[model samples]
Target: MRPNHSPEYVQSDNSLDVAPPYFFPNVDVQGFVIEADLKAVQKYCDDFLNLGTREERGFEYRAVPAWPFAQLLFLHYPVMISAAPDVVKGGNGRDSENPIPSSNPDFIVPMADRGTTSQNEVFAAIPVMRYGVGPKGLLVESELEWILPFIVVDQPWSCVCGREMLGLGKMMSRIDIGPGYLPGSFLGEVHMPGWDGNSPEMQHDLPFLYVQTGPALPTFRATEPLKSLATAFQAKPVRWALEKIAGLSNFVDDASLGLVPTTMQTVALKQYRDAVDPECAVYQALVGCRSKYSEISNLDFYDERDIWVMFNYVGSFREAVDVILGDELKKPLVVYPELDKTVSITGRMAKVVGAFKFSANVDFDDMRVLHEFDIRKDRKEGGHGQVLKRGSSDLTARWFRPLKGFFGPRPMP
Candidate 1:
């Protein structure tokens, strides 16, 4: 790879010859050269090719060849600096309560009229540089400079630079959180040109690592049911509520489904705990379900069906109760109720109601999961094959394994 170099600035009439803010390359080229073996290189290429093409929400795209390697590098290395809490602190000066405030008016730069200075303000910043193959098997680098600060005030979840960084001008597209390489984690995906520029016919749906604690606020809001679930079960209550409501008949066993047996209380409690408790088998199954969805989205496109299904299941439960009892079952019902009015004071029903309410307010498009990506263990274990000896001269000529087969099925000449 070419050694990291600072940008040269041209003298201007009003401003001194100042270099534009450039994102520094974060990958250790010499380390990659020494550590990467043929098997590892081949696996990286295969993973990229396996992504193939994807179509979602009427948009078609593919994964760039360098995407896998880049993802691995960013996740495993300390390339990204987590945004300080103060950097994204809300206007009220609270750390996690409010949305990040816009930059000061004096610091705002005027560009093409976006109609608001908030859109022009900078909030949280992440500098990224991509590595790929060049002509003559040389490693080339490209900087995502314009896409630095991910603004929060005007457009909460969108990158301020948007498609301008891709040289595609302004587009309706916005960057969003998607399934990550690991379960219970998320990554950022956007539609852009491939690294090689080979696929002019189709855009690449590239995925990259982002700082989890960045300026962007979560799109999904936790509802009462979700809160109750977390409080009662310390797990995803919305998912649990949906499952319980979907299989209401199995638990209640009533033709009208209005009456529930008080004796089944132990069974119901076990079922809920089994599904939500991290130590239980059903909890692993839930995690597996999330992992499977992530795998599917990586191969195809991000699908909202799974999320919608959870919400739909909850709605169906609500409808069933309303039809059978002629009254709304405001909470999720997992077991039969006791006739004793004193039992109602135990707050079990409140938890159920919260879960049901959470389902109704669930925003399928706003879901995200956390993935912990750290390779310190691998380094400690000395799993990085053979690394080259470090020296000043050796660092200058850093090399990276050529990523072949990036462009899928090149047309025959």
Candidate 2:
């Protein structure tokens, strides 16, 4: 239940003297300095800040199409940490209704995550996507959230037959990439708000699309919008979560080579479909892009189809983009979010809940309150805070901060 964080992790290069009297006149999280390891975040910020110039979109990460999205998996990041056990123990066998984390490669802590202010809810991840150019800057989409769900096993290997991890029902969906953004959009958008107008990284760019589960969307569309069948199943993991991950690990090796034949299920799907039509394929080839199928296939499922169609559709759709790109429809540049190595440094890789940069501009009240403007519309332990969107002109803006910039569209069910 304790936070899996350390003082060294807190030592950030961006660490302002929030330690007291000398902090910014109206700085947010005043007095409390960011982790001293602010350099990771600072570098991440700087890279994007210099987005869209000769070195970026024009040349691509390494002069490759999908490289931007996949290449940045080498940066150091300080992410939020959480345990997969907490997610499983938080509810029934299939009730993976946990709030989405703000970042990836984060640590999930049970009791220590409480936050009286938005800034207190910091998470971690190496921002892998490059900001690209778009209509205004980068074409920011709606909200789409993603979450990885699983139940670990003590010793059972996931690749075994009939293992929940190896079968069809062992996965969950968290975020969905939308239609507009290409693979390199993240870096493209960096220049939108006049983002480093003359940075070397800037060039024509492509952006990846995804739905945001910004904690504000009315409903989640990534899955089959949980059924209204009014049926409650047992809470035990008939199929363990970790078992499935092990199974999936064997399927694909590189994220860019597309998904590999890992489990009997995915393997079977490929086989069966191929058998049915030696040429025409139903399950499209997995794009080297980092879609969630790799993550979803590892969850323990209650209702199998919900997760199935979600990933199936997402992968298929992204494949279509490849087809478009092949037609010489190549945008000036494209970017997909990549995970920097700020991970590996953490204990056991964990879920990211939040991450921020520059400084959070929260307003304190006369009573030194985080905010006097709004209340947590619905406070459910382990559930989620009613998060506001990036540009929601509503009252929720003051209640939450848009650290992720509300990119892509909201996820579909």
Candidate 3:
């Protein structure tokens, strides 16, 4: 992956050089540990707690990856500094083989303005780099040179082939949060203090590490029923009023659709929680009916044009149920879907829904499950597996694992 910022406007499509979100490379129980391994997770989190900001710019810790790694710049020498937050992998930068020198070195995918397909923006293949040693290799070393007290960092990066990525620098830190974006200020050309208007060659240096903080939007990823379930808990009086109208036949039957309490740390809405436990209510209604989605979106995409965005805001439960249950549960609903990252909320079960067992449903046609993780204690242990009976919104029942995952997937090396 490359740093999300650019040296100049013509050089990259990055208008938002804001700090990269620390949440890149998201991790979950059955997912890969982004960048460093488990050891790094605790270390990085601890670093922010102990030495991070509120004092000077240093290790800033946040619930998501958007603020710290993506924003703060790290200094190395007197001439250059590192790019905060790196961009998703792909895209041959201007200096790189954009309209690649070619498979034939002359075969360019012309742009429409330049007389070619509009969607066919010529791009060369970007080489993928792996850490090599860790479970999934992470960046271990790189330099950030200080160009001045306030200007942006300027330098190049060297790839495994010894070819220099002219404008690229080493990514000091890389990570992904559950589902959050970093501020735009950290990634753009840094504000170089004391930078002469037309100076030729000048430089300065200062202490490196920096940190910042912001609110943590902690939410979970569930199907339409799950979110609709969360909605059911919006207002106590409304919920209570609806329940009376719901009656026995009206409720959706599932194993447990209630609030996955473990998922609520920084619940975005207190009013919803205080009013109802839609998570539990919804889960129970959907029990035996369907629990999760069918096929899951593959989290890893090797290019900028493709991605596995997280679906955090599963539609509202109360509204859905209101429609399913009747006029008694009338309430306005909102759609809350996350546009990035993967997430898992433990203790996932529906109260009034159906009483079903969780199971891993892999297919002989797809071996990705085995390739992604090792099999361990089945769904019984509650490791990483599918809870049977996916909802209508969840793709199809086919989107589950055939076998349970005892541990998370290790990131790419």
Candidate 4:
């Protein structure tokens, strides 16, 4: 039998610099697991993830909400490269330009070089609900898949490739990770393009997110009694490793080491708006992406410390923050004095559940189109608007109608 080898999509013309199979070698990553509002996550799944599959296409991708938690990843790549099909197809000849220039829309910014270094990224991953559209539209429960609801990068190449190639919705932003205002603590902040409280255009300078971890604690000291006690409840490996490593018992119980070189199945909503019709999308679908990490080293887990996370609600980022942390009970952190009184900065801060840091080689590949939205014709015919319409009375108002004589206004008596 002959093996099949063909590029899925070729760089026929002056397209993007790289296609698929993005490689980020020796990536330094800081991961934080945050306790999220389940209701908000469910609503996010319904509106963002399930909108294309269930509402638009009339298929269901329900939110499982098994775990009410979200992942905040801060990645710094020492060297980043991708598989360039254009160069492979003999487009970069001796006479051809060394780095082909991409002239696209205003939003599509081309990267200077295909293989670049010092690329930084910060993203939020939410637990995707379990739903499957199998053969003949059969529903099947699948394993947990995560969705990148919010992500920002410092490189234009990363932004372009992420959005155009993988539907990652990567936005260009400035990220800072280092010593925080607190003594001996770590801080990570993202200042992306957003609008002021009242502005027509988006201001390119505004801090939208901030993550501060508690003071650094030693590995052995932090994990000793915690890991020893946790062995009784769960994480049986801790007890086993402790038993085996008699002399090195104190250091063997690092539970965070088990997560090194992780593999994550991520999903994104890929959509392109119609150039002519602003209300319609020419193409929209859910894209499934897989990222594999290997050659892991220097893994540090900080489960003992707490993470302080704040999401600033500015411009388009408000909806993204609302999806993860519901606006049920939020306390104001930063407030400015207005004309009459003080106004809090519109945002929410989440209590950190756990955090960890690691370095590894990351590979991004395996793109799959899970489900596509309905076509224009199908949408107009089969969508909810075309179905039967119904109305309901306000029950609360109706119940108070009879009490108008006693409690309600009777000629202002």
Candidate 5:
């Protein structure tokens, strides 16, 4: 909105000088200022007034970027104007079938499309059994392990998109360790906060730590191709976008532990896989890493299977295990993309939708005393003496101690 009052013009040595509070006050409109594009500013003002209306709402408004810029501009010179509520609501409308609405005065405002770019790629977490050099040049088969899904993207946010486009879920909850003396006992008692009987103050018995492995690959749904090619392209951008929104570091500590895959390696692997299998089918294109499972009751003493054994021994451990191993232990953890499920992408941006599934078994032998209570006086006074006399469960002078304090002394029976 332009100001109603006009500023006085004065004659300067070279040209006419406008006084304070000139039209478009505080805005540098000098012709010599080459950076200022008057046409663009005028269009923005016109659009602000006319575009966000009931009849013809603006498309591709890019609100993600535009809103902050508009706020900065408004901060300098506050303006208040009232118009139709739908006018300010732009981009793809609520319903996919009718993204943009016609002129309905009572039309409901739909969720705006996130005006950011995104990419897509296939991802999988397979159990790999491989041989590696041990301490004395002897090759040993690496313990049975599942590789966390590795994602890469030109934009870090797209990493999330690529994972999602491949149909992986979000991360599992933070792992909780319970007080225990042995690694096997520690594994068996490990639980997550908010789980049925676990609490934050419950300290782990052994020295141990665990981290989430980013988002997890989905298990229930059958494997299928990603919804669209555009979605596939958004994979990298989506990951970075998520990194920006929610710190990716919070999900996993990649720097300390070399668990997360490198960006270059992930990209290279996807390219190789896609090139070998152009169809881009998740299951057909990806190689399955064979997983071996031993029943909890039959595991060895020092094997990782100790976790399974401990888990079976304590029924409380079932909740966390069920999240990773699925409701039924008989079912193997399977990851595959689903073409039927799709996330809305805007300008390479998409919201993280589901939770991830992560499984980690921590084992350390070190022990620490958490808390202690003084019971020497109680022991000497027989405070904890068992009631062996055959009488009704009633108070008796022989089983009780009388108080001797400054207030008063009591006689013993």
Candidate 6:
């Protein structure tokens, strides 16, 4: 065998960036639950998260609409930072002094004067169905899995690191949030670089997304310490009521399915476009990641009547939003009454099912490759779309070895 390469030696001089096991110590989140059209959600899952055929196993990943709604969440980090502990102790062949770039604070955005403004992001979480065949040839659906189709972040470093490292497809945008636009409420807008006309010369920053929190009704704030935002909104009665409104009361279980609790589990499509052929992908994969929150406090719920969420049909962003949510700008379920003469809502506003806010210590870790797409042929055209099977499970004993004893006998190698 050839001599093992030194960890201190740069793996690739062309790409010298942060390595994974990323962590975020502080994260403030504001979430809004929107009742979405079921058909739209289904189409999105089929188009993006569809797991193609495996000729040998005779089993493939499939997506069905779990719930007819989406979660629009805004995350603002007060002291945004990243660290790579694996490289610091010289575990991966690198010396302690020659650590990865992430050993230093790769991205640091100090809290603004008013708080929650330095690093901001807005994303939509529409849970797609993940099912597999069981031993008895029965389909078992995993409700905990979902796909994140849309996300925009302000920090450039965050955008690069998130996409390259964790497979978080984050776009660069100017995200503004917090009070001032609406009294006793929060307002958020995502300004992305796009064109007003048909040419690149017209490209400029345009606010295509708008979300405003109306003042909540005199609801009591839960002071008790909580685990996550999902737990805070885990009231069965409320969830069941919302499900009933969506005509899913009969199909869903009262205990689960309606409102997923804590540790948000999600999947993302990570891909790199070919340098020679922009249409073809060099590498593509479906990555599974979990966002677990701890030390959650100051959880407060809002009356649905008080929250407003809307998306614009910009030519650039419509392909992404409309493919999932339908023609939002032209078609709308409810039209807001003419309150401000200047403001005209051409796009659609989602029916707010639930709204909440909380503070927590979030960790953006726990990620692994769930599936990888064959990039030889174009997947979009329905060609060579099989998933590459892994030879063995990707687990290291140093971490999970202790827990193995707690379980039954280990599997024979």
lDDT-superior candidate, 1 or 4: 4
lDDT value, candidate 5, whole model: 0.22
Position 136, candidate 6: lDDT: 25
Better of 2 and 6 by lDDT: 6
lDDT of 5 by residue, 84-125 (tens): 122222233336676556663334332122223322112223
| Runs in model 4 lying further than 4 Å from the true structure | 1-16, 52-59, 84-114, 133-141, 180-185, 198-204, 219-261, 303-306, 330-343, 378-413
> Candidates' lDDT values, in order?
0.21, 0.21, 0.20, 0.61, 0.22, 0.58
User: Best lDDT goes to which candidate?
Assistant: 4
What digit string (tens of lDDT, one per residue) describes model 3 on residues 1-413? 32254253232322212221111111111110011122332243333122212222111222232211111112122111122323222443223444333434223232211211100000001011111122221222111111100112232121110111111112212222222133211111111112212345443321111121121111121122423323334334644543453323223122113211011011000011112433221111100111122122111111111112111112221221111122231223222222122332211111121011111111111101100112222323534455342222111112122221323453355
- Please state the error at residue 150 of candidate 4 in Å: 0.5
Model 2 C-alpha lDDT per residue in residues 144-182, reported as the tens digit of each score: 111111111111111121122122111111222222232
Of candidate 4, the 10-residue stretch with the lowest lDDT total is 389-398
lDDT of 6 by residue, 18-96 (tens): 5554456557778788776666665666666564554322233444545677778888887654444432223333346
- RMSD (Cα, Å) of candidate 3? 28.2
Evaluated with TM-score, which candidate comes out highest?
Answer: 4
Task: State the displacement of the C-alpha of residue 114, model 6, in Å, after optimal TM-score superposition.
Answer: 25
Which regions of candidate 1 fall more than 4 Å away from where they truly are? 1-6, 9-413
Candidate 2 local distance difference test against the native: 0.21
Off by over 4 Å in 3: 1-42, 46-52, 57-413
Q: What is the TM-score of each candidate against the true structure?
A: 0.16, 0.17, 0.15, 0.70, 0.16, 0.69
Who is ahead in TM-score, 1 or 6?
A: 6
Clashes of each: 6, 96, 94, 2, 43, 1
Backbone clashes in candidate 2 total 96
lDDT (C-alpha) at residue 37 in model 3: 22
lDDT of 4 at 216: 42
Error of 1 at 130 (Å): 15
